[model samples]
Every structure is written in structure tokens, then in C-alpha cells.
Target: MTPEDRFPGPELPETGPRARLALDPLSYGYESGDHGGPQQPWAGPGYGGQGHGSQGHSGQGHGGQGHGGPGGAAEGAVHSGESSTVRGWFEAGGGATASGFDPDAPGRPPFEPTDPPTLDLGAPVSAAPPAGAPDPLPEPADTAPVGPLYAVGDVHGYLGELRAALYEQGLVDADGHWSAARSRLWFLGDFTDRGPDGIGVIDLVMQLAAEAAAAGGYCRALMGNHELLLLGAHRYADEPVQSSAGTASFLAAWRLNGGQQNDMDRLEPHHIRWLSRLPAVALEDGHLLLHSDTTAYLEYGASIDEVNDTVHELLASDDADGWWDCFRRFTRRFAFRGEAGPAAAGELLEAYGGHRVVHGHSPIPYLTGEAPGEDGRPPLRITGPHVYADELAVAMDGGVTMDGRLLVARLPLE
Candidate 1:
């Protein structure tokens, strides 16, 4: 059977442990030399999204050699090598200095950059106008439009699909260079593993960061579970781990999850450093953006900064067990699914401060109970994101790795 055959039939009504652990073999790649043991070809049961062709990385690492921010916190700082376009945008957005804007800071307000401009409530109104002479309302001043905000779901190495989606949104020019000036884009992560061009996907994102900034817009990403898995495979390799499914090694798990060999071979220190700095959770435009569907994030920290800092610090450490623990928690999913999903999403929103949670990990077809079409293939098109949990959360994964759609939706789900 071919790798496509590995895709399971329509998802079951209920997600079981087996469904949660369904290994999308097509998602992983292995360099022939990287794994010493006999290659486990995709002849057996595993996850679905596997790519037969090899993908290579040709681009070099970015400026700062991976560490660009002042001190150790690279968050919110611009790379020195970036063009003046992006540098100006960064400076305009107050990226030059750390205002120490904490979402959960005591006596301070949460970070809600997308909030509407506030009006002064204490302005004294002119003495009541005489009965027949009402003062003409001052004409409203004209203001330039702020660019639209865009979010892309899991790419899973489908570089062509990704480029097409971005082009469709006019975020990228025909040549795939950043074109949406003053607009913002956020990638929900999982650039590698499962599919054909993981490294290529990462390279594009890295390149676009500079281009987008130069255009007066910015592109940012969140850390996904697959990123953690890849890091574990590279760092811990075959080291054993304590898993609920008995003992397992990072390398073994990586291969099982469709980790590509070519992507691994091309993995560099700069890439590792870049991945390490990614924030696991963020609040954007009042939407809580995260990679996984699970509430396991709360285990890391109460606030977004705390959680991101903890993950970064853990990655910087050399403790294999600590890395294993971090990987294990990230692998969890569906914390905001099923009947209990709304309460979970609400709890997270209450604590993190957001009207709704937007994420990319679980697919919409699975959440909406839409079965694969005839011949066991996903629908040709996905109209938009799946809003669930009483509209408390919006799922964007679209399951590109599962023969489903690659979603890129505008924010503030209606």
C-alpha cells in the first residue's frame, strides 16, 4: 500500500487514545545516515501524512546567528541584518526598548494591541446649546486603514500549497516575497515533519520575517508540538523516556510521527536556536493564539510570558529528562474538544485574557464530524475555520497532513 493508504477512514465519533496517538508517518523524514538502524519503511500501521521525495535546505542561517535580541530575550526585537523597511516597523512598534509589557502584570493592563482606540470620558461638554442652535458636530478626521491580520494553519511541508494560500491573500507577491504592507501574519507552527518540504517551509518563514517587516508588516510564529519533537530527536536522539504508552525514545517517536530524514540532515544550530526562542502562547488582537488544543499549557505557567520564558529556559538547558517532560506535555491534544471543550476554553480565556481562543492542531473535519468524501479522500475545499466551544475557540489546522485543507483565516471570527 502507498503512504496515502495509511490515512484512516472518517474519524470516529469519539476520539480515543489510539486516535490521539495516531502516528502520521508521512509527517516525518529521516536521513538515511542519521538513523543507524534499518529504515522502517511505511509498510506498517502509523500516522498518515508521509512524503516520498527528499527535501533539502539551501539557505544559510539568519542574522544574530539566531540570537538577535538584547540580553537573552529575543522576543519583540528585530534582527540587525534585516532591511531598513522592517527595522523602521520594529522601531515604530516600540521594539527598540523593552517596555516590559506583561499580559499578567500586577496593577497593569493585559496586552491587547488590537483593542479599539479609547475615547476620553472626562472631557467637559460645552454648556448646553440654546434650544434652536445645536453646535454642528465636528467632521470626523480621516485615518489610514490598518492592514488586515492573517493567520495560517499547519503547513506540514506543503510549500506549494502554503505559497498559493499566501498569494491568494495577497500577503506575498507572485514571486512569494512579502507584499502586504502594514498587515500582520501569524503562523501557528509545525513547519516541518510530515510532508515533503519541512526545511523549505522554515526557510521561507525566516526569509519572510525580514521581507514582511520591510513592508511595514510583521510575520510571527508559535511553537508547535512537532517542533518540540524535532528538537528532542536532534538533542536526545535515542534516549529513553517515560511515556504513558510505556518507554519510548525521542528519535523513535520522531520517525513514527513522519519526521523527515532530509529535514533532519539540514537542521542547523541557527534553526535550533530560532525554534528555541518561539513563544508557546501569545495573545493577539484579543485572540489567544496557541498551537495545541490541549490545556497542558497551564502546566507551564499562569501568564503567557511566564510560559514562554519557562519553555525557552528549558530548551537552553542540557537536562534530557527536562526536555522529555516538555515534549510529553506538548504532545497532548483535545483539551478543548468534545462536550467539555467549552469550559476548558473558557477557563483558559479567563486566565489568559481573551474573548476567544484561536488555535491550529485539531482539524475542522474531525471537529465538525465531516467524513472523508468518496474513495476516502477529504473534501476538495474547506470554506473557513471551525468555530466551536460556543464560539469560545476557533480551530484552523484543517488537517493539511490528513488530505484536508490548509486554512488561512482572518481574525476576530464572526
Candidate 2:
């Protein structure tokens, strides 16, 4: 059955902080040398024993509930797509011919590849001055009126749940239009897969983006693993691609991970362009935000700016293997769990310049090893974002796939 069929409890009966769940001693996958190796300080497998074929994040079904799917910063944002973990179960080998970059293929991006894509890096536009140029003066901070900042985690495909969450925050009016005047909003990605109405969710987010910008506020999103998967499936279809463990095709992987046909059928060229334009990571108000909780982002660049640039550049390209590689690295999760969790969060913070790392991808219930009620225990009640890794990282995915709430929270959590 699908994640939606599997998890049918409640769509968030409560809100706010709840008691912390006890963590299992061996909750984190941690089998070292899977990829990061010893050279990378915060490297290891996702969930325990998960490898290229291991289960990291779960996918959901139709309606608005489900699970889904992360990477590194090179010079810009995560170009290698935060270096995701590959999930091809068969043996690795493929004989497919070159099959990307066709204009008719969904891989043919509609966005102008020439544009710098600096629209939402969220990083200050300062790195190195021109040769022999004096360092640029620090710009004045804006004192303009601004609304509160809020973040929504992995919507999967649940449009209704997302609408309620946004309405609860007064972000949208009764008519479901952007009503947050000057309030800033960010979607931590995973807009599709495992649920229904992913396209609808994207439409709402796109609408909000335009309306919010016009209102002097803004709506933005990060790239999620499912986005990459959907893009790949559209571009390559059933064409086989090589992965660390085996040969897999984008179409198969996408479907295996809760990719719905309706979303694919309704996907428009404009959607492709918008998805391609999204950055893999961003930093604002002292918070570093991303999709998955993996250190593969380090594989992309050394800073948030570099990581975002790299991801955009890659998505704009027609290289199917490169796209698959990107998807694989981001899939590797559980970086901020177990005893090494704090250190993993530290790696991203020290490199990216955020006081704390806020992310979605790994659901809070899975982090505690029980997923609440799954093992015959009472329902694992998730009321708010999970703060762990010594309080250095916050998990925003509320496991909507498991009948959990689609979370939306104010930033700078107390």
C-alpha cells in the first residue's frame, strides 16, 4: 500500500511543543565508509544499515499526507544537488544511450540558464571584489516594515493540509490568496511525491511567491529530492541510469518513491522552469535552511552561496547521470542523529555561517526510532518542529505521510 494508505491517523490534532521522544541507542544508520569515509568528518549512512538501497525517507500517497526526500555547497549553493544518496536496488550497470537535453523532454528547462539565479540565495551578495578592487563597503540594513518569518516543511502532495497550515498562520485569506502582506515565507522543498495534489501545492506556492513579492514580502522554496526525481523521470523516462548499487531509471525510482501519475500528467513547462530555478539551500535571519539532513552538501561547495549556485547550474544542465548522482547524494540522511549528530550539524554551520541548521526530509518520529504507534506503541504525537543534535539542528518534517501534521512554524524558535 501507499504511505497515504499506510498512515491514516490524524492531520495534526495538536500544535506547539510537546514532550521529547526517547531516542534509541542505535537509531542512526551510521555504518561508516558507505560514502563519506574517514576523510569526511560527518559522513556515514542514513538510517541504520541503509546504503544505496537502504530506506532513508518514506514517500506518501494521494490527498495531502506522505513522506519524501537532500547535499553540499561548492562555490554557490549545492550544485551537485547536495550530493544525494543513490537508491537503485539492482546491480549497477546500464547500456542506455544518451537520452537527455531534448527540447520535447521535460529536462529541457524553460528558465534562462544565463541568468545568475541569485534571486534567492538569501546570502549577502559579497564574496571577493574584482582584482585589485577595494573591498565593497557593507551595505546599510533595511529598516523597512516586514512581517514575521515562517517556514513550512515537506508538503509532499497534500494541498488541503498545506492550505490549513497556511491559513492557521494567517498567510492566506478565506479565499486562499496570499494575505501575509509583508510576511516572509519559505518552503523547505519536497513539494511532490507520496501524496496527492502536488501540482496544486506548487501552484499555491507559486501564487504566494508572486503575491508576496508584490506585497513587499516574498515566498521562496528550496530544491527537494522528489523535485529532482520528477525532473529526471520527465527527462529520461524509463531509460536506465547507473547508481552506486545498481542500474535504475528515473521513472522507476520516482514511482517507487510515491511519484503520482496525475502530478506528472499535469506538470507544465512553467513548473519545470520554476523547479529548476529553486536553490538547494538558503540562509536568513541566522537560520540555515535545506531539504534533507545530509553532509553531502559539503560536496557541492564551501558556503551557502556556492551550494545554491552549484545546484541551479546542475538542474539547468541536461546531464542525466549528473542529475542521478545529485539525487543519490541528497538521499543519504540521518547525518544529525546518534552521538555524532551534533558534530554533523556543526559541519554545516561552521561552513555555511548559520547559528543553527533548520531542515526537513527525515521525519521526527523516525528520528526517535519508533515512528510512534508503528511498533504497537501509542501514536507518536508530533506537535511541533523537533529540536535535536544538541539543539543545533531543528527537524521540520512533521511526517504528514504518517497522518501527521503538515508543519508551518515561525523562525528563530525559542
Candidate 3:
């Protein structure tokens, strides 16, 4: 059977895992990859509205946009619709698995992560406003437009940083409820591994998804390479794969990276299914949201919809090699940097739809290429989102594993 056969037909209920939101995916413009068959709409409570697709792909709808901001139209009431076609990040390598932003340097994690560290909040490492946020969103100069679009960098299991950052934006109240009624939130991916509370991070994101949808806004996530690792580790558990590096398996890679025992122990079947279904690319309000800044996405498909669909299909199947291939592609990084960076970013924007690429995965410090302190410490402290590659790409991994910040930023960065 084809990959399309892997999914339940339209006759299935939308309430099932990762159901598509009601409303035509086409109305929002762009294509959301649809397997060649009738589509089923998600029966999200209070979530009946038009959904948006990325520039050129077809697949699952990103998020359904409801009433704009305070006025729903004054200006800025927008959803990340940017992530309909989403992918992840990491380094499987040799061009087959890695997409180097630099093309010459190593593309995966520069080093195994430091043990999950706590942020020194007192330090002045906050990302700037309008682009990278630590400050609460100021009252809209005018009526808030559709819930203003916001994208988060990789959480990497840093639940405390995640919660604090979300709270700062007033997205959640002191009690962590969905307070950003109409604002759209997109987590760029990498919800697990290398940190202390991967499971907690997943739980909170899941909770926020339901709460946000109910409140008329939406909270969606793209899958990251770490998710791939977790799933592979779970399913294969040391099952060897064909690798240039002998005897490698997903579990080994995950452990070599920062897979936490607590997280693996806490993972649930629902989480696996949810991760399996995340799209690999998307375009929202002109932003091409992704997990890694690699051109490897092109190999998946020419358009965003095709990329997402292809990824979804692979994840839905039992093709260990196929899944491993997907992991390698998303893990490639630095493709959108250097003299050729603009072209790389342009390539994605040209194919996927979106003016700028917003992604997580490669930490900002890696993008800057700044070495450690003169005294020999880790790389430079990150100041949140790193806008480089001639501004075509925005790197949002704040080096949280290294005790740097976790960023949650507004898009179209003022």
C-alpha cells in the first residue's frame, strides 16, 4: 500500500490524533499537502474557521485562524499559518542526513549538550523586543490584529524557561492558563532531549494546544529531530541501521546527544502518535517556519505541502530507513548561512512560500560562530534570535542547554 494508505480515510473521526481543523485548507491560500483522497476535518471545539496553508505545499492545515485580534483586523491579527509545512533539526551527515548552514562545518550539534542547566534569569541575556521577546507584548499600538503570530525556539526540555518566557508574553496567566485568547503560538520543534523536563514540556504544549484552540487561538508544534530520535529509540531500541558509522541506532544517537532517562520513561503512546503526525514545513503570514535552517528540506519535496506530506507519510509508516532518512534531512543545519546563505533561504522561500524563514534547532551562538570567553568558556552568550544569512533566516535556539535563554518571539519582527 502507498503512504496515503497509512492514514485513516476521511470516514475517520477528526477527534483522533492530530486531526485537521475544520474549514477548507485551501481557502487560506497556498497548499496543505493532502494525500490523494477525501480529507477529514478536525472537530476542534470552538475551532470552526478558515485554515491557512504554506506557500506551495499540500498537507495538514497549519492552524485555523479565527476572529482577528481586538478588532481581528485593525492590523496584526495574524496566526503563524507559517508552519503548515514543518520539519525538524539534527545531524545524521555526509549530505544524506545533514544540511549545513555553513556547508563546510559540521552540521549537527557541535557538542553533546551540557547537562540541563538553569537560566540565570538575573543576567541581562534577554532577546530584544519586536523580534525576540522577554518583555510582555506591549498593548497593541492599535487594536490587536488577529492573535499576533508568535514562534518559540527549541524547548529542549527546558520547561521552566518555557513557562517563564510564555508568562512574560502574557500568553499564560500566573496560573499558566491560556490567556492569549486570539494570539497564535507556534513551537518550532525539539520538545525533548538534552534537558530535564522533556515530558513536562510535551504535556504543557499539549495542554496549551487544547486550551488555545478552545479560546479561539491556536497552539501548534512542528516535529524536531529529537522527536525522531525518541521515536526511533522507542521503536528500534538498539536495532542497528546502515550507517557510515558502524552499529549506530536511534537509541545510541539519542543517548549520545542528551536523551534523559526520565523523559524516555515518561513517554506515552499518545505522544508518539502526535509526534508522528507533525508536518515538516509551513508558511504563515509570509514567514517560512521551520525547525532547522537547512536546505535539506528541498530533498523532501519542491513545495512546502509536498515536504510536509512526504514527512507525514514516512512517519506514519514502519519504514525504519525512511524514518531515519527523514531524521537526517531535518538534522542538517547551517544551509541558510554564509555567502550562499541568502540563496539557501531564497530557495526555501521560493518553493515553500514565505518572505522570511523562522526556525529553531541550531543554537544562535552556533550561527554567530563566536568562540567561548577569552578565558575559555562555552561559546558566547546568546541574545535570543540571531537574524543573519542577510536577514533571510532567523535562528531561535537560545542555547538553553548551555544555560542561555529560551526565546519566544513575535513575528514580522518590527
Candidate 4:
């Protein structure tokens, strides 16, 4: 068999994160004398046997959601608008062969200079109830000009669940359009993968973004590690890249980490652009919002804008190793779980300018060790968002993918 055939494809969800270390380009060039040689910090088994992957930040476990069918590629589908410069560079260095890689693949992206995606930001959208639905009670015309600030946890392609959560908060109307005018909503990231209808979820968020802005409100998102993973697979599929274990590729890693085929097939240019440009960090009402709970973001930039801009620029580049570094770091987690957690949170706040850090990557059940409900189902109530690390951090990933709650909390938890 050819080296390509002998090379292992993506791992199973049950595989330890150590399996990932083999694909982390950053893990290459390191010389360790350990069993598998000097393994990197992320090059280990699951965390404390809690089932966290070696990818560290991915909370996927045996029971975790995201296990799905392989994303099938449309044979011979060449990526259109691909930058010849990027293709040339990769080809020059024996980068992954682009010949048979699926062009419609979700990850490999091309550069296009377009205005940052904006929701309508135009005329006010009239909230009209559907037929047979009672007219919604009118709010006082003098309601607060700027509505409440709220955030959502991970929605791993569970579009129905996300819609329900938003609707419960009155953020969306019965028809699933933005209903809360003048209200700000933020999705903490991980909108796709590991469940059904990831693309549908992105579509909804995109629609609501426009609808919300048109109604004098705004809906925004943050970048998650999965987004980084998807991009890497798209850009460097089957490319033999350096790794601690020898050679690896993003396509294999993405598949093992719950890359949904439907999501990839349905991916469009707009979706790629939007995901690529998502901010890595943001401060709102003294709350610092991050997608993952790792301190690795500091490696990207010294400040919030710097971090986001740096990440965005990196995503635009054709550097395979650079992209892997970003993906690896973003997959780190548990920076605020132990005694030093508060201190870690404080460090982010000190640098990023926020009173508290709000994040969603590690699920709440995993953090608290809360067992699933009776009958092996997820618990009915999560109570509320987890305020931990001496109240310096709040975790919103309620483990929705694991049948856990999908938390939607207002900012500035008191």
C-alpha cells in the first residue's frame, strides 16, 4: 500500500488526545526521550480520566455528542477561486496534494476582500406572529432603548435546541426571526459539528444577525477551535505535514474530532468568510467573552483586538503550521478549573480589560462532575451558568451536545 494508504485516517472519538499530538504541526521538531519521545504538553491521554481529548479543549467523550458520519467529498470538485499563490506555495513545499481534495470541502478557504459581514443594520423589522398564533402582547413603547445583553452556550448543530433557547429568552419570535429589538445577543461559539444540522444552525445565526441589526439590535459570534479545525482540514487535507510523531494532516484530525459531512457539503463561501473572521475575544459590559477556557489565546496577541486581528490574519494565510498552532492552542482548556483558576482568569482580565471572563468550551457537567439524570439521560435542570474560579469566570457550555442544558445567561452575573 502507498504511504497514504498506510497512514492512519482520522481517529475514533474514543481515542485519547495523544492521538492528536501526532497531527499538531507544532509538535514536530521536538526531540523528547519519553516513551513516545518528548511529548508536548497537549500530547497526553485524556485529562484525569475525565474523558477530555488530548486536543485538550474539545470536551468530546464517549457520551459526548458530535459523533457523526464521515463528511463525503464530491469527487473531483476543485475549489474555485483558490489563490494560485497559495496553491503554488503548498505545491512547492510538497504540501498536501490538492489534486483529489474535495473543492467543496468546508475547510480550505480562499481570500476575498469583503466588508465584514453585517446583519441588515437597516430598517426596523416588524415582528409579525404567524397565522393562528395570537398577537404577541406589545411591549411599552418606552422600553429600554438598548435591550438586555445575553449569551448562549455551545450549539453543536442542534438548531432546534438553539432556537428553543433563544425563543425562551424572547430573542427570537415564533417564526424564529429576531424579536428582541435593541437587545444584544452573543453566541459563545461552536455552532457546528457533533450533532445534526450544523449548517442549519449557522444559517439561523446568520439570519438572526441581519434581523437583529435591522431591529436595532445586534447578534455576534466568537471563533471556536472547531472552526479552526475545519479550516485546517479544508486548507491542508492529506498534506503530509510535520508532527511530533512524524507526519499528519488536518483532514484526518478534523474527521476524528467530529467534522460533520453535512456541514462541509453545505458550506458556502460566505460561511467560510464569516467563520474565518470571527473574533477570538471581546469585552462587553465588563464581561470578557472567550470560546475556550485556555490561556493560550495570550500567545496570539497581547490585547483583545490584537488577539482577534492576529487570528483573523492567520486564518487568511496559507501557512499550514501557523494554522495548526492556532488550532492547537484554541483546543486548550481548564485554565480556570483548579485553585489557580481564578488567578488564570484574572490574568486574562488584566490583559484583555474585563472584570470577568465568560467562556464556553468545557461543558458544565464535565467541570462539576454532575452525572446525567435518572434513566441515563441528561439532568433536567442545570440551574444556571457556572460561576467559578472565585467568581472571576463563568462557564456557559452546558454540554448541550451531551443532552445537557443549553445555557442562555445574561451578562454580568450577580
What local lDDT score does residue 15 receive in model 4, on the 0 to 100 scale? Answer: 22
| Tens digit per residue, CA lDDT, model 2, 1-414 | 100001111111111122121111111222231233321212112211111111222321111222111111101111111111223321233222222111121111111112111111122111111122212222222544266788998888888899988877777766667777667899999998756678999998987786666565678899988888888877776566775434556765665455555677678889999999889989988899989888889999998889888888888887888888888777656677666678888988999988889999877666655354323466456777888777888888887866567788887777
TM-score of each: 0.66, 0.68, 0.65, 0.68
Candidate 3: 10-residue stretch with minimal lDDT: 4-13
Q: Choose 3 or 4, whichever is better by TM-score.
A: 4
- Look at candidate 3 and tell me the lDDT of residue 210: 70
Q: Candidate 4 on 85-123: residue-level lDDT in tens?
A: 332322322222222212131221121212111111122
Which TM-score value belongs to model 1? 0.66
Per-residue error (Å), model 1, residue 30: 28
Model 3 agreement with the true structure over 146-264: per-residue lDDT tens digits: 67788898887778889999988778867666677778889999887656678899988887777766555678898887788788877765455654323345654554344555676
Q: Go through the candidates in order and give the C-alpha RMSD of each one to the true structure.
A: 19.0, 15.6, 19.4, 12.6
Q: Compose the digit string of candidate 1's lDDT tens values, residues 276-362.
A: 899999898899999877677888999999999999999898877777677766655555655566788888898788898988876
Off by over 4 Å in 4: 1-145, 371-381
- How far is 318's C-alpha from truth in model 4 (Å)? 0.8
